[model samples]
Target: MQPSGILETALYVTDVEAAAQFYGGLLGLEVILRAGDESVFFRCGSGVLILFNANKLKDRPKGGLPIPSHGATGPGHVCFSATRDEIASWKSHLEVHGVAIESEFDWPNGAHSLYFRDPSGNSIEFAEPKLWNLQ
Candidate 1:
């Protein structure tokens, strides 16, 4: 058997609070959980987005099974699926909140996407669902 779908995606951020404000406040994602200053979790349509404090997790003691503590330094990326109409609305909403739109792409298949950075500089994208389907 093979994996059916992605359940969660994570990004390393320096400040959990600022990440929360950007994901929850600006994007309207629901803050599902917060692990003190270490991490924050947001519910994103059928999946979970985890914002982790890289510095904090880097020093945590290892537990059984040798599970690696995941963290990153440079910008991470996560893309969310939206409808064409929703993509347009998102552009307007982001502008209203003063979030800069870094760039936008129109795929040859006619799908479009908007790219922007979060508080910790993780590249976030919202693209039309059709962008991911096999042409």
Candidate 2:
């Protein structure tokens, strides 16, 4: 295999299925591969993203995955694009689900974006790009 950039980001989540639901169902990503209780690999663009059991990977973080912590979520966020309607849909979905909204920022490009945390408290950004063109 040839060398390349980060092909995956594997998070140790409390609930893998929930992560899949939010990232796959809500975010509209197709599930690429899901293995038993071990881990799941997702097809994202030209690469893959993964989620492993934090408890299982605590002892050993395979494939350069982040080391599991007692409660630390580290830093930064994961971003996803949305269809115009989807972006509007998320505001309601998150509120109905009881997830706290962190902040919503407007980019100079006219992109409309919102930030929120997942069940595992990982930062996630949902964005609609057409707003950028408007800007």
Candidate 3:
């Protein structure tokens, strides 16, 4: 059997509250849950964005199901889908919030994207739907 689709994505951050402000307050994502000061969860379309304290996750109890403990120090990346017009609007919105635009890319398939960083230095991208089209 093949995999269906992504259900969740995560980014390790130093500050959970700051991450919540950036993803929830600035980006307008719905905050689904928060695990005290450990992590914060946001609803993004059909998937979820999880921002957790890397150092804390490293110490999480490894239990029954043999779940792997994952954490990273530096930056992580996640891309969100948007329309061409939405990309433009997002660029402006990010700038107004003092988030710098790192770059913009024009793919051969006509899809475009804007790249930037979150408060924790995680690389974030907003690209048109055609970004993953194989044709």
> Which lDDT values do the candidates have, in the order given?
0.89, 0.71, 0.91
TM-score of each: 0.92, 0.64, 0.92
| Model 3 Cα lDDT, one tens digit per residue, 43-95 | 99899999998878877876856867777778999999999899999999999
Per-candidate alpha-carbon RMSD to the true structure: 1.9, 5.4, 1.9
lDDT of 1 by residue, 1-135 (tens): 999888999999999988888888888999999989888999998899999998888778777568666677899999988887888899999999888999998999888999999888999998988787833
Give residue 102's error in model 1 in angstroms: 0.6
* Span of ten consecutive residues with least summed lDDT in model 3: 61-70
User: What's the number of clashes in each of the models?
Assistant: 0, 4, 0
Better of 2 and 3 by TM-score: 3
Q: Model 2, range 18-94, lDDT digits (tens) per residue?
A: 87887787666778888666567888877777777566556554556465344235543666667657777888888
Q: What overall lDDT, based on C-alpha atoms, would model 1 receive against the true structure?
A: 0.89
Q: Candidate 1 has which clashing residue pairs, if any?
A: none
Q: Candidate 2 has what TM-score?
A: 0.64
